[model samples]
Target chain A: MSTLTPTVPAKPARGLRSTEGKAPRAQRESPFARVSAMIVMGVFTLYFLVPIWWLLVAASKNRSQFNSTNPLWFADFSLFENMGNLIAYRDGVYLKWMLNSAVYAGGGALVGTIIAGMCGYALAKYNFPGRELIFNVVLGGVLVPATALALPLFLIFSQISLTNTFWSVFLPSLVSPFGVYLARIYASASVPDELIEAARLDGAGELRTFFTVSVRMMVPALVTVFLFQFVAIWNNFFLPLIMLRDETLFPVTLGLYAWNSQVNQIPVLRDYVLIGALLSIIPLIIIFLLLQRFWRNGLSAGSVK
Target chain B: MQIKKRAAAVALLTAATVVLTGCASGSTTSGGDAAACEPSEGKVDLTFTTWIPGMEDVAAVWNEENPDVQVKVQTGPNGNGGTYQNFFNQLKAGNAPDLGQIEYDALPNFRVQDGLMDLAACEGVLDAKADFVDWTWGQVNFGEEDAVYAVPQDAGPMAMFYRADLFAANNIAIPTTWEEFAVAAEAVRATGGYITNFSQSDINQFAGFVWQAGGSWFENDGENWTIDLASPESVKVADYWQDLIDRDLVSTNPPWTDEWNNAYNTGSNWTWNSAAWGANSIASGAPDTSGNWSVALSPQWAAGDNAAGNWGGSSTAVFKGSKHPYEAAQFALWLNTSDEALTMLNKSANLYPAAKSGLELPALKEGVEFYGGQAIYDVFAEASDHVSPDFIWGPTMTQVYNDTSDGFKGAVTGNGTLTDALTSAQQSTIDALEAQSIPVNK
Candidate 1:
């Protein structure tokens, strides 16, 4: 991690031919190659970064400037006003929605990630009966889209009298098929059998060995799983739209949607909707940025080993 | 083994307790409280759902007036989808609120389905049936006998709102006829900018123009359905607008979006085709553009012989599952057509009342400061009388609008010619209406 590549071609004064033979021919390279690469990467960066930049600049503008001012440039600093309006609109209901999202995402992802990790570890290390069949079934769940299952889940929840409750959303979020699949793939590759065996030999039980050793080794992968599940639950709209009838119980996505649909009729809500969209995406970006190191570590672990 | 058995037994007991408690609580409360309040009704709890603008104030007023009856205002999806879905779910669940907001076009749907209570059954309710304009009343009843599902609240009578300054600068007058209007539009385009902006992207607005031109999407002869997709009225109106787009006399943008708002606020468009409700949006959103704007009667088609038409209106209905039908009906009537209620709505958000008496209020007669002191209500009220009585909205009207709007996008956006666009839209609408089991002419 600390070493830098040797510069100046190892100072081989008499071996230019040998170095030339070893290195690929530079004559094959196109003139536009570097330029095109730079342009492509520049565009890719702009495509992502521009929206975030606009969000920051627009969030600083007051209601009037939100419509009239340049979307890309900074206007009068009114992030305070925007935040104030957001908090005070409908008597601070926006804050409640933010809190609800945090609870739903934070708690849901935590519990869901732990379950996925355990399930994945069990499938990867243990020689259980029907293991392949169960793994295949879990993979099959990924093929069926979330929207197709929402109505079925609604019906099931209604049957169990669980509709219109926190558990209706939280319970479904916990059973993420994609999370399970990713975790399983990661566990098989990242958590070595030697580590588990070492822990077991050190007088640890199966559950204790899995938790203390396997979990520590799988931290990077588990964090990746947690972040993905958290963002998914945070942005979930359709399920909450169907399940929750009470406006007070809505997550930010559904809440902002309800606000957006009315912006046409009530023009005052246009700025509010834009500002809300701007505010809601900030936490998502921050979460991704903070967790990226762990995610990258997890991705490159097997390559290093 | 003993310890394991004890834990298992404890878990089973806990699960049983949770299930029993969950089942026991909800049934016990609703029955005990809702039933207790049902007969005597001293402190009535009314759950009301609506999408009407300024409804919170109305709820506040009702709460103040009837301190004994606690009214809870629930809003559905801010637009049509939420309103329809919530209404559908509530009806299916048999737990709909006491009152629901019904649009004039959707009243027939509710009427056909037996989803509403008969408002005639409630006494001491304001007799708003006679107060509303006869056509508005007809709109509420769905042309059927003995089935009055709702009372009229407001009618959206549409007109051409033009900038007087732009017209004067262009040396043009408010065109009195459709042909003259086309010429004026051209001159305005040559002088100022885009001459006019109607939401070609909105099918309902297009249908209003088609209906005003005496083109019916469906015609019923008291027994059977008659579909008319290629009526002369339909073709003429469609062609006129398509020609306008081709000539670059109108905007290509959808209404009420950023493009539309830009055109409106910047005076890029000389005229806007809108209903009376548009006045409130204009007044509030673009306060600086006040004195430049004025209202005029819509240019009439030579065939229709009228300068006006209806676009949107709201009705108040008592849902079938309402616990307080009598109170709900009384409140519905009072809220719908009473002069006091309309006055409150108009004051808050310039909602033009459907009731004739409500429209006849001193407030309604006054000119709006926002429109260069033009008597906005007086113009709309005059237009209300000339509004085509035979503007029959079919059950598949929304579907037809969506199809036509999608089709016009190609023409307006310059992707295709008008004839081809209309043809595609006509075919799609025919398919859509047929799928909905609404009869269409071959």
Candidate 2:
């Protein structure tokens, strides 16, 4: 692919023995280069950070500040006040939503990651009959959007009497085809064949070999899968909105949306919504930052492989 | 390897046990017989669902008053009808909220769907139902006669809210008649101020205003969908608005949103068309500009127009299959139309009293501080009196309005003639109605 391109322009095709002889001088900087770069980066930074900054500022204010104060600026710091209000609102339901989200995300991601990692490792490392067909089917699953599958999932859950339960959300998160695909690519590159072959020669059972050797090698890939599934489950809204009727069962996203809708008529909820939005972003950010070291290590190992 | 398999088996069993325990706990409590809650037990868990913001105080007051029956309030998600949809799903699941808020436009939809309990079966609530304004009560009427299934929350009486300071600055008069209103708009335009703020892009509001001009969207047979869409009355209103848009006397504002709020707040437009609840949005959100604004009677279409059209209001209904029906009905009546509840509601959000007796409170008597001490409720209550009960609404109102928005935009933006726009709107409305199996005018 690299060799297909012509080295010289049509007019200069026959002029030189080596194109390296005609290297051009360093180009002069354009008049507006620095200014344009600064403008672009400025807008890009503001585009991402302005709303977040506003959220942080707005989250600190009480209901009155939300209504009366400048939206982008900090007023009297009422973060504690807002937090107190949130916890106290309707007998600490916000805390319950948070706990529910943590349970759903924590339990679902742990199980999902293990299943994806093992499946991906097997598909990549083992040369079994019908492997390609199974992989193809898993790849095909990636094409279907989650929302398109939600109604079918609901119907299935209804038949099984699992519609309004935690399992309805948990079970669906475990079947992540994209997670499997990622794990397969990572495992294929990371785990060498010699390791598996050596383990088998030592008379180690297949399950023992996977547990002691391949699974350990797949840690980074599994963690990545866990984080991906964790965020997906944490932010899950529409399915829960459709499936769950009990307020006690609601996740924070659905909970916050419920508050946001009433802000029009009940102006006081405007602050609650702003505060809720600010709090919502914290868990995801903390998770990302905490697990970033593992991600970096995964990248480096991939390069070595 | 044997040890590992055994450990996995133990872990799986633990997880299964946890799930089974959760299910067992739920089933033991609510079980197959959900309606087993006895009123005589003296402690009932009555769930009141609503989309309204300030109903908590109302529930609190009721709870405070009644030591025996406890009411638990659950609010639906804001703007999105999550609560209604959730309530509907619960109804199917046989665990519907004991009491819930219903929107006025959605009353007929609920009635037709068999989703609601017959509130006529509720013994004590029906006694107070007659005390509400007939038209307000008329909204909850499903069939020809008022076989009430829901109680009114508020009457959305519209009036012209104008920036008095801005009008004074431009020397524009608040017009009494439709002709004078057009002239006033022109004069305002000459002074470089927008005379009105309206979302001509919303055909529902357009249809609402047309209805205010004594036009019906459909005739009595319920099949003939006729509005004075292009009738002399409607065309007069449309052409008058079109002239405003063309001559730059109207601000190109969308209704009841941040854009419209900003437009009104920034003094980009001098006047807005709003209801009793509409004024609440303006006054509450813009407190600093209170003295600068005032309300006037919304300009009449001709000599005598029913100065009444609804924008939005909520109602309370008993969902079918609630466990504690009688207790739920009691709580619903108390939270919705009770004088004490309305009084509490007034303190929190200024919701207009749904109960007729509630309209006579000190809050109603005392002039509103937000409207420069103008007697706001008295004004709205008078307007609510003239609202025609004959303006019957159907289930397809929302769908028809959505389909006709493009035509409304075409007319407002001057890309099409008013007659063509309305003609297309009328046809689209019929099509939408027919799609729903709702009768349309021939």
* Each prediction's TM-score versus the true structure: 0.82, 0.78
State in Å the error of residue B224, model 1: 4.8
How many residue pairs clash in all the candidates, one count each?
A: 0, 10
- Model 1 pairs in collision: none
Model 1 lDDT tens row, B1-442: 6346534543453344334323434344321111211232577788777655457777788889988776777664553656665565556555567888877777645543446665544564335566777778767655543336677788888787888888887679788788988898878787658878756666666766776776666654432345566577878888888888878888777776656666777788777767877776665455557788998888887734655767888888888767777677667777866677788787764678888888798898887788888887888888887676666665555666666676677677777765565667667766754553433565
User: How far out, in Å, is residue B166 in model 1?
Assistant: 2.4
Q: Rate the local accuracy (lDDT) of all candidates.
A: 0.71, 0.69
| DockQ for each numbered candidate | 0.18, 0.21
Scored on chain A only, each candidate's TM-score is 0.85, 0.84
Q: Where is model 1 chain B poorest over a 10-residue stretch in terms of lDDT? A: B29-38
